[model samples]
Target: MSSAPTPAPGTSTYRERLVPGPAGVAAVVLFAVMCGLVVLVSSTVAAAITSLTVLVVGLVLVAVTSPVVEVRGRELHAGRAHIPVDLLGETEVLDADGVRTALGPGYDPRSFACLRTWTKGAVTARVLDPADPTPSWLVSTRRPAALRAAIEAARGA
Candidate 1:
């Protein structure tokens, strides 16, 4: 198996934004509208204000709660979890079909996956550490090629 390459100290190689989809935003808005409708039976201005407040807060929450994926220094960070680049073996950039398969039929129970429904692209990296139970990492990303390139460059460093 190929081993991970060392990276320069304190350098960030990659960062992938996990934005919520249009459907998700729409759902939030729908919920806010429903809330406003319920309050509409009372006051118009108050209902409008409530709906706007809920919409803004809901959107902010969605953005804030979205998991971040980044390759910083020698580690690959996904959400709240991270692993040393030296423990990663091979990195592969995955398209939509590959992502579906990787998350479906080809999935391993022990592998770590940071999936987002909004993203169709992903990156898979083999975990080389014998001591760790996780076999690999399959993380959803908007920029699959860039993520793969970052991991490869960090590993090669």
Candidate 2:
């Protein structure tokens, strides 16, 4: 894991940048190569165009799919949703089975999720307010325990 960022005074910050996994990378490459081959079989001009098109598509997919999780200034930012720490209850690390449950049967449509198929572990934050549509927040993380600790620190738990 990389070193976490330090926020200014009065804030405990934890930021993580999750990029495409090995499999994702492979998929992108395979797509480009396969498209190139298929086009090359037809015409060189079309193959060149296909190569460029595939490259752009691959980059866009990875860029849009990447998730950045951060906790700063009493707020938790996971993907696009931003929630105040005060509204959060207990936060914990989720293992493989726990992740499956949280993302599967236990999933909430309103919950904020930046899930990635490549990610194996996650961190869950319970919503304290029943009125809120979201029951909880499930965020994919490479370092679930560290993220939990960061949340605890933010909550002064």
Candidate 3:
């Protein structure tokens, strides 16, 4: 018996690029204005601290919402976090109901590691190991289904 031939390596079946939506842009702009106000109204030391904090936070937010999924070579990078090609498993696109189910209660936290709450949908990728520090990432994507398919295909699943 003969098996079907495999496609060329590093060839991706789907690809999607996600950027900040209107809400995210508004947030960045608002934060920037607030930082400027701090500089305008306070001492240089205070301004420096406020500006630094804002800058760091803004960068992180931008990073998180930068791109939901990228498939290149044999790897997949979701948002600011990177997931190895080999460890990836099944992929699913979550609609509103799916998001609620996957995230559970208090899904949106006010600070640190909080996935952007305003995303239209999410892509959940299965992980291989139980002890892996990189738990499944809930990525904010405008095109969640496409992103999930791309990730799954890239992983050769």
Candidate 4:
């Protein structure tokens, strides 16, 4: 098998970094607390099994969320999702009201499936393919404007 190419220093190419924010930290802490509680409420054997399972799953989530976004060459990877730079079209930075309006009905903030509610705002990405059911993705970000600009620049390249 061919070895993977190394990334150049100070370049956007092949870079993967967490989209640093309070949400990730809070999630880790919350998971830890929940796991602890589970251990406290269970029998010795049950506690050991449950705690180990939770620890593994929680660590995986921490790893995934720790890197909010990763730019690997022309691809952008974000929280269990990935998109090609070329496939990205228009971008919009939206506030709470704007996000609600843009997302339309069926929006539920509690679900992790959607962007975390702790996010002050979001960056909405437009997909190039008309046939794609997911027309846009709402990303929670501390700096929506900056994220939008970065994605736009990547797409332009």
Best by lDDT: 1
lDDT tens per residue, model 2, 1-157: 4454444545647888778788877888788878988989889989888977997899787887677888877777887777877799888788878888887775778887877767789988889988898888888888899888877666655
Instruction: Report lDDT per candidate.
Output: 0.87, 0.80, 0.63, 0.62
User: By descending TM-score, how would the candidates be arranged?
Assistant: 1, 2, 3, 4
**What TM-score would each prediction reach against the true structure?**
0.90, 0.80, 0.56, 0.55
**Which lDDT tens digits does candidate 1 get at residues 1-157?**
6665656778888987697888989999999999899899899998999899999999999989999999987788999999987798888898899988887876899999999988989889899989999999999999988887787778674
Q: Sum up the clashes in candidate 2.
A: 0
- The ten-residue window of minimal lDDT in model 4 covers 7-16
Error of 1 at 120 (Å): 0.3
Per-residue accuracy of model 3 over 87-149 as CA lDDT, tens digit each: 766767788788778777745342113145666687776667666755565666667777766
Error of 4 at 10 (Å): 11
The clash count of every prediction, one per candidate, is 1, 0, 0, 4
True lDDT of residue 54, candidate 4: 71
Q: Which stretches of candidate 1 lie over 4 Å from their true place?
A: 1-8
Lowest lDDT 10-mer window, candidate 2? 1-10
The reply for model 4, stretches above 4 Å from the true place, is: 1-67, 106-114
